[model samples]
Target: MLTGADGRYHWPLPPATYTLTAHCPEDGSGGGTGEVTGVVVTDGRESTADITVE
Candidate 1:
């Protein structure tokens, strides 16, 4: 889990297809959640997945 003000995270993963999910807890105002699937990570390469909630 990420525990900072920047709201950034990193994970070491092997070369394969994967799925990433993020969840925001419910507050008095509101809450949201998001996910990304089919993420491909290759050896000696960089992969990116973006999730946004509103």
Candidate 2:
């Protein structure tokens, strides 16, 4: 999934562990790849994960 113009993304997933990844290509702009492992999503709650590309 891609993020909006506000640089934010969301996904509705079942309660479980997950890995989130983000990638930016070298299109003359900033380019990098970031990932977050072991993300925990729970029932009746919102989970937030942040990946910093370098």
Among residues 3 or more apart in sequence or in different chains, the pairs in candidate 2 whose N, CA or C atoms overlap within 3 Å are: none
Candidate 2 residue-wise lDDT, 1-54, digit = tens: 889998898889999999988898788876899999999999989999988887
TM-score of each: 0.72, 0.83
Full-model lDDT for every candidate = 0.81, 0.90
Off-target runs (Cα >4 Å) in candidate 2 are none
RMSD of each: 1.9, 1.4
Assess candidate 2 and give its TM-score to the true structure: 0.83
Which candidate wins on TM-score? 2
Cα lDDT tens digits, model 1, 1-54, are 752576767777899999888888889658887888999999988888887755
